[model samples]
Target: MSQPRATAIGFTAVLLWALLALFTVGSAPVPPLQLNAMCFALGGTLGLIWAVATGQLSALRKVPLPAFALGTIGLFGYHALYFAALRNAPPAQAGLIAYLWPLLIVLFSGLLPGESLRPGHLFGGLAGFAGAALIIVGGGTGFAPEHLTGYALALACALTWSGYSVLSRRFGTVPTVAVALFCVVTALFSSLLHLMLEETVAPQGLLGWAAVLGLGLGPVGLAFYTWDIGVKRGDIQMLGVASYAAPLFSTLILVLVGIAEPTLRLALATVLITGGAGLAARASLRRKPTVAVSASSDG
Candidate 1:
């Protein structure tokens, strides 16, 4: 796929993720790990079927073991740390810290080969972070020293995801189909954790079941495959900046569905996140990619 097309495809993941909060709310009664297990199981199963139908099943055999390990760990570890963080601290505070991945992705992309860190990228990243922070912390929740453990875990969650995303570039040769296996393994891990940690609570109704299906098909399933293409071949810096829109869009979705009330804060966040993304997009469009040492060539 062309770089532009791949980037567009990747942005769809962000759009899909906007529905995460809404779906999770609708999927009530089900615990987080159980929900994760069900969604990923559905996603992975559908992905495998798609692979078979498209004759991509054979291609999966060529993927390196390290890629599988990385993908599974990235997916599973992130949620584990996030759930732990929320348990140790306030949700608002812990979530704010965890949302640092987008900024981290932009910063970390500077170290990637053939990617230049522009002033616009840095400024845009900060702007986006500020906007996201405003939305997350707008409830007047303050961090307490008592929550240090949760805060640390939340930071680790950010590092795990950002590191996973940036390092994914090095494995550009890995087929996106491999994400199906990753999701499957992640589902197994989640199922084990759910069984060990919490009692099973099935979805409450049709709405809950539908929400789980939606999450599986969109956010948890196709999003990973498209994101693989974007991070590996598209403008990583731009996508990093653009990711800030997820939370903002999520809020808007909530408001549209009558789950959240609109506020001045939301309007301001709209400007900052969109403006930051636009600035980064302009810089990405103006600058040309240069020949540099490939990340895969490094030890």
Candidate 2:
């Protein structure tokens, strides 16, 4: 597919993921590991069916084991931490903390074959970090000492996801195949974790089931599949910049759902993360000319 189309799909994934924070929170009362396992298993089943129908199941054999392993760890590890963080902290705070992956993605993308690190990226990363600090200090959420564990988990989520995305892009194969395998692996791991550490709590009402379905289909299922293609083929810099919108979008949804109240800290965090991404992307744009020139000379 064309880069433009891939970029659009990337943005679509971002929007869906924004809604994910809200839905994940709705699953509360449900154990994190159990919830993740069930949702991911369902999503994986859907993806597997699609892969078969689209004739991409054969591509699975071509996918290297390391790539599939990393994809599973990235997907499952990130969500595991994310769900735990949401359970312990306010949705906005957790979302803001986890959204740090966008800045990390910009930095990691520079390590790709045709990408380069620049001064703006450094400054932008710092700015984003500063924004995250402000969120924590300015009464965003997670003030108690007990909440520190969740905060740390959210931070780890950011790091794991950024590294996962970079590696995926650097070694991407067929999107559907990769995502399907990732879901399967994550589901198995999550289920195992649930058995070891958490108790199961089935969804109680129509609203609860709806939340599960939304997350499984939108974020866990289609979002990861499209993201695999996007990071491989789309403008990574653009997606990095676009990801800053997630926290803001998630916060709004939480507010609408009456799960969270908006705060001054969240507003400031929006400015910082968004502005930092723009600053980093400016560097990306400047570096593109060099990449184009290099490609041309090589050709």
Candidate 3:
């Protein structure tokens, strides 16, 4: 596919992810691990069905074991931390902090062989962290001790996802079909963890079940497949900048649904985070020709 087309396809994942926080909140009362198990199971089953129907089952066989392992760890670790974060902290705050992955992706991409870190990238990182600090410190009221663990987990969630996305570039030859196996393994792992650690509380009512299904079908399911294609083949830097939109849309969803209130602090933090990502993106774009050459060569 053309680069622009792939990038556009990849951006769809961002749009889908905008609903992640909302669906996650709606799926609540169900423990994190259990929620992870349920959503990934549905996602995995659907992915496998698509693969079979498209006659791509043989393509999956070509994917290396290490790739499978990496994909599983990324998917499982990210959602587990995210689900737990929202449960422990206020959803809007925690979700914003976790959304730092896009900025992190921009920063981390500088470590790629042909990409050079610029002053703007460093400054952007600081700005993004400042925003996160605002969230954690509760707009200068000092640490919200009760939510520290959740904030910390959200930070870790950002790191895990950014690392996964950057590293996935190295496996550019791997077909997106392999994401099905990743989802399957993640489901199994989540199920095991839920069984061992979490009490089984089923989703409460129609809204709850709808949330789980929404997650599986949209954010958790097809998002991964399209993202795999985008990051592996499309404009990664562009996607990184575009990702800031997810948090904005996510928080808006929460507010509209009455799940969270729109506050000055949230708005300010969103500005900081989005501004930081834009700075980093500008640096990346300045060297776009070189980066594109390197990406093509690497792929």
lDDT tens digits, residue span 112-135, model 3: 765567777767766766665555
Model 3 scores what on Cα lDDT? 0.79
- Tens digits of lDDT, candidate 1, 126-168: 8998899988888776899999999999999999999999999
lDDT of each: 0.87, 0.75, 0.79
TM-score, per-candidate, Cα-based? 0.95, 0.82, 0.82
Candidate 2 structure quality by residue, lDDT tens digits, 175-291: 545587789889998999899988778887887888888888887777887777667767676677667666567776887878878888788878887787788767766765532
Name the candidate that leads on TM-score.
1
**Candidate 3: minimum summed lDDT over ten consecutive residues — where?**
290-299
The C-alpha stretches of model 2 lying farther than 4 A from their native spots are 81-99, 128-155, 289-299
Candidates 1 and 2 compared: the better one by TM-score is 1
lDDT of 1 at 24: 88
Which run of 10 residues does model 2 get worst, by summed lDDT? 290-299
List candidate 1 segments past 4 Å from native: 291-299
